[model samples]
Structure formats: C-alpha cells, structure tokens
Target: MTCTIFYSTEMPNEQAKVTGGIPTKPMRWAVDYVVKTPDGRTVVQGEKTIQRATFEELRAVMNHTIGEIGDEVGNEATFVSWRATAHGGKKKNRKGGKRK
Candidate 1:
C-alpha cells in the first residue's frame, strides 16, 4: 500500500538554561503528523513533543510513528510522498540601511 505523510514542527515558548556564556533558550519541538491513504483517507494522526529539538530525536519520533501506522494498517505501507515544515521565530532583517 502507498501512503503519504504530512508533518510539521513547532517550538514552544518554554525555555531551559545551559552552561554557557551566552544565554540560550531550551527549545521543545512539537510535531504534528498525519497519515493518508491513496484515496485521501486519513489512517492515523496525532501530535508528539520532544524535549530536545535535535535532528536525531525528531527522526526517531517520525520513524516510530510511521511504524505504528504501518502496524495499524495491517499491511506494508510504502512512503510514496511526504512534506515537512518548521514554524519558529521571525527572520532577522538583513538589509543594510540606516535605521529610520
């Protein structure tokens, strides 16, 4: 069976401090995922949160979710397509101009 997945990551406002001269906020990654069949039928969908916003952690969550979906579907589901997006802080202005 072929399935498509859509996922997005959002950073919460909660923060933690680390040992460093510069102040940094501890980011928590919240992932929302949806699994759909070929006919646009949603098989499963839910949200998961990771304490640390690292690539490895995110990947692990995604993999585990997909596995769960496959088991629930009762078939070998192949990932035909997927989409991902990240929502976070605003981008800094890079234009070199005098402040108004």
Candidate 2:
C-alpha cells in the first residue's frame, strides 16, 4: 500500500528595502483564518505570520529519520530514504541515536 502526503511551503513577502536612499511602495497580502469564541459561533480569520523557514526544514527532518533507521539496522549503510530539496546543499550524515 502507498500513502500520499501533502506538504505546504510558507514564505514571507520580500521585505521592503530602501534602495539608493529611495523608499518604495509597501506590499500587502490577504489571507483567511478561523477563531473560536464563547458561544458555538467561532471567529475565523486569516492573518500573516512571519516566515521561519527557507525550504530545507523538511529535507533535514527526513534525513535525520533515515539516519536513525540506519542505526537500527546496525550498519554504516546510507539510508536510501534521504531526500534533498536543493540541488547543491551541504550533505551531512544523519544524526541518529547511538547504538549499544
């Protein structure tokens, strides 16, 4: 059996900058979100949140998991489950739990 997984990438707007000592127009974004209130009725709204990741966060998590599984197999074998979101980023051994 195979399972389908969906991942979302969130990025912040390009921060405004003063170029050549000139100011530019501000950028705006529209979003939707949900909220809960005292009664069954809930307040749902969408707002912006500061972006906290680039895009490799998922890849790092996957690599870490693979490293852990490799350790369980008791070998220096590289976990084939590794994936990369970037073409040329530094590759580091997955950090896994130590074996006895």
- lDDT of each residue in 1-100, candidate 1, tens digit only: 1112243322133222122222133335555666666565777666666674444445566677777787787744433223333344334567975567
Report, for every candidate in turn, its global Cα lDDT versus the true structure. 0.48, 0.30
What root-mean-square deviation over C-alphas does model 1 reach? Answer: 12.5
For model 2, residues 1-85, the per-residue Cα lDDT tens digits are 1111122112124222111211122212122223333353433323332122233343344445445544654534421321121
- What candidate 2 gets wrong by more than 4 Å, as runs, is 1-54, 76-79, 82-100
Over the full model, what C-alpha lDDT does candidate 1 score relative to the true structure?
0.48
The total of clashing pairs for model 1 equals 0
| Model 1: ten consecutive residues of lowest lDDT | 14-23
lDDT of 2: 0.30
- Alpha carbon deviation, residue 25, candidate 2 (Å): 23
- List the pairs of residues colliding in candidate 1: none
lDDT score at residue 70, model 1, on the 0-100 scale: 75
Give the number of the best model, judged by lDDT. Answer: 1
Model 1 segments more than 4 A misplaced: 1-26, 76-100
